[model samples]
Target: MCPCGFLLPIHKGETLPSSLTVRRCDLQRFLKVIRGAGLLSRKGIPAWVSLDASSGVLRLRAANTQVEVQLQLEAADSAFEAIVDAEFLKICSGKEASSVTLSLADDEVTASWFDADVPRAARFVLRSSDSVPPAVAAPEILATNEPHLLEALREAQATTDPGASRFALACVQLRSAEGRIAATDSRQLLVQRGYQFPWAGDRLMQITPVFGAQEIDRSQDVQIGEAGNWIAVQAGPWRIAHAVEVEGRFPNVDLVIPSPSSLVSSMSVETGDARFVLERLDKLPCSDTLHEPVTVELNGSVAIRSRQEESAAAVELVLSRTQRNGNECRLQMDRRYLGRALKLGLREVGFTAGGGPCVARDAQRDYVWMGLGQENTISAADVGDRLLSEESVGG
Candidate 1:
């Protein structure tokens, strides 16, 4: 007898021949992984969904041409197998039942459960497949206890240009020897350091797995490995495998960043104040795209304003710290690129003035972007600078 007041039709010690009882929580957990891998929708690029249980282990697999995600759970001793539509799992996992028993037939799957002592059943058509979803077999494994691997992947992935003609620009380059992950779209670049991995190759890993990695619990150790042209990561009971770019070579990003000695001026600001400025500019009547140029005036204080030709708006914020070898500097940067850097959750942002690419650094990572030209002069009489008190902003 179960807690729902419904007895599963099995003797005290005998298991159901063809059904497996799974907790609703487990089903929801795997569904999150499926959604993270960009497979939850039935739109373009269909994902194959397969479930199998044997030897007290239950496995759920979802795969597309770009990525594959699998989740494992412990189950009672029984043999069960089924291939169903991703939507079917979505519906079954959304029910309010505490636990559901899944029974597989030749062409259908039956989900039976108890709803407040009332029995309920739903039938879903099974998908026909000659074979189950294929798995990537990687013989090599680079297991690391690195706590920030996921954080680095997410930060670098944002800089990738998915539509770039150069395929390498659409992937994140792993610098195992230097313990760094870097990505660039020719317009902007982001590099995160302080990672220790055993990978010896210079292959470019696709960014698709970064989506799947977000679904994994951060407390688990993520194991990364490469096999030929594929890269895989295992975190807790979830495993993600992705194909890598086999032919293209990632460009050397270190050449674009300016050296410390070449920096002319450096200004620092509290992250909270910077975010407030960005959010205010975003609310202006500007293009929905992040392409709008925002000017940064770096001197004793930091000032930001949108460069929309027809609108005049300005906000001057007190700098938390500053150091400069020359006069004040001003540069026009894409609003979107600056926002991406702030997403890394760094407490402070250091804007460096140089002759080359624009550079922004935090305690852990470096961000560089190109095509930063001088902005038109904005005088105090045109749009008075609203000086914000330091006590008004919270970090």
Candidate 2:
């Protein structure tokens, strides 16, 4: 016989030819019985969907009685349907079934397949398959968005695994509508709210998981479904098993947004905005075009610099060109964290230059506000030398 266990031998004896096949009627009847009666042991070793290959029929013994389910593979329009029984399909739907190990001790079901391995014959412990994670349930949905916002969010990496937890947890205080979606993390925040206010909710903010942001890169449906206590998220080919929402309220975020800046009337051109925080930092002072980002920009009229008297190198976000008449502003941030916000996006941008408060307005709506943050300038021999060498000196 071949290595696959097919019957192959010298043409002799009373054995039938290898070309013979099982009958159609018999195959159908066996499948019907399994579909109706057999108790599927999903956690059993050599766990097969149809009847066991070695055992001609599947058997479930209870007390003094025994029930058998017969099954065989053959051609028929409904051949596979008999295999899709309620309990069987449910088992297959789980994350992935590693070697199913049935825990039958003295002939009784006990631990999950991943758990206890019972003794077989005289010795030899079997494989584990006992711990079955609770079935996944979808989160309690707070808001829903149209396909457009979903698409744009994908471009920014919102639906992947990294972003799932963040997106799911940030469900509170959300504004659900048809335009955009936004979330934040432990460090910074975001506000991609409105069509004319494309974002939904009282404020534009988020706290999404890192995997979700990665999912955003892949444009696909992100449907959340839950049954009983299990939470499930279907994004592209990935299915996220999320825990049920714990009882609690998300923190308030509106207190953090900075005020908006008036458009400089005199300045004809200005730039500097990145898709994410890193890009924003990169464009901080490369050149004119480098500084100008159509969606968001950082332009100041005065140069602000700070260096410490003790140690630590001083850094600043200078407002290079003030053609439109504005104060110079410096925004120093951890390059990495800044990049994360850029990916989430903003509704409007504001500038804080000349030590004066800056503003960020909701361009899609009438919402506008001011923000207060702190950082000390590195004290140098004087502010003059610091100003001259700063990146904002020219534009």
Q: Evaluate all candidate structures by whole-model CA lDDT and list the values in order.
A: 0.66, 0.31
Candidate 1 RMSD to the correct structure: 5.0
**TM-score of decoy 2:** 0.39
Q: What would the TM-scores of all predictions be?
A: 0.84, 0.39
**Residue 370's lDDT in candidate 2:** 25
> Could you say which candidate leads in TM-score?
1
What is candidate 1's TM-score against the reference?
0.84
Q: Worst lDDT window (10 residues) for model 2?
A: 59-68
Off by over 4 Å in 1: 1-16, 41-45, 95-97, 115-118, 125-133, 209-214, 271-281, 284-290, 307-313, 320-326, 346-356, 389-395
Per-residue lDDT tens digits of candidate 1, residues 250-344? 88888887666666665554556666655555653333255576666666566655534545454444433333435577766676666665655
Writing each residue's lDDT as its tens digit, candidate 2 over 1-395 gives: 01111122222222222111223233333333233323333344122222122223232111001122222233222111111122322321223222222222332222122212322111112222232222233345512323344344332233222333434334423344533333334334444555222222433222123232332214654454343433333444333332323443444445554444333211211233222223334433311232121112234343333333324344343334323334433443233333333333432334454322233334442122222233342333333333322243222
Q: Report how far off residue 226 is in candidate 2 (Å).
A: 4.8
